[model samples]
Target: MVERYAVPDHQWDMIADIVSPPQKMGRPRRDDRLMLNGIFWILCSGAQWRDLPERFGSWKTVYQRFRQWRDDGTFEQVLSRLHLRLRQDGLMDLDTWM
Candidate 1:
């Protein structure tokens, strides 16, 4: 059995909580959320996705997943949900600017 490097469960769970699971249609071994998180981490760190560390898996995989999510509106849905949740919690008040 190939030893899989265990990604932090909590972090993975949080990411999963924020985003809907990708439909399993292609390769069964591919992890769409992990790949997308790696791409997001790169963006948040202001680094190129190509510079992503090996611990996050292949950079190409992450990049491809990011592109797929972008095209499918997955990223937008996640962001919108987060924004709405924040607004509902009063953590982000648009009316403060008015």
Candidate 2:
């Protein structure tokens, strides 16, 4: 029996709700959520993508997804939206002299 890890429902829902629907493509598709999460883990942890754990799935898949998101502007959009929300919520401090 393959064990499936549970991504926090709120976090998963936030990502699903914020991200644009995967674009329609002619080719058969591969799972994107695993790849996106793997890439995000690497970025958040400041670790090498190749060092991503097997539990996260293939490093190549994550790298490919990262590149695709970059090319498609998805990553930028997500970051921009997050920044905007943080600013609106007063969670982002812009004070330079601390």
Candidate 3:
């Protein structure tokens, strides 16, 4: 079953390219949407990484990806881009969010 906090396809499409850029070499990466859903589950549910659902794959993998993204400011970039997209679409009000 899909997780409750899984990002919908439309939303995922907005940030997919930014979140998981085309890899240049080596083995392919895990599914970003799944990992993102797992990350969202952790953040929204306030659960420990160890408690991550199995559908999201190994907790360690998700944790590691989370760390990599965190250290690289991926989250910030995603949020910025999302904000821009939403505002341009008239779906978000910057003042209200702030």
Off by over 4 Å in 3: none
Give the clashing residue pairs of candidate 1, or none.
Answer: none
Runs in model 2 deviating more than 4 A are 1-7, 17-28, 93-98
Q: What are the TM-scores, per candidate, against the unseen true structure? A: 0.67, 0.63, 0.88
lDDT of 3 by residue, 73-92 (tens): 99999989988989999999
What is the per-residue lDDT of model 2 for residues 20-78, given as tens digits with 9 covering 90 to 100? 37667777445666666677678877889889989777888778878888998887777
Error of 3 at 73 (Å): 1.3
The 10-residue segment with the lowest total lDDT in model 1: 1-10
Query: After best superposition, candidate 3 residue 61: deviation in angstroms?
Result: 0.5
User: What value of lDDT does candidate 1 attain over all alpha carbons?
Assistant: 0.69
Number of clashes recorded per candidate: 0, 0, 0
Model 2, residue 76: distance off in Å is 1.1
Stretch of 10 with least lDDT, candidate 3: 1-10
* 1 against 2, candidate with superior TM-score: 1
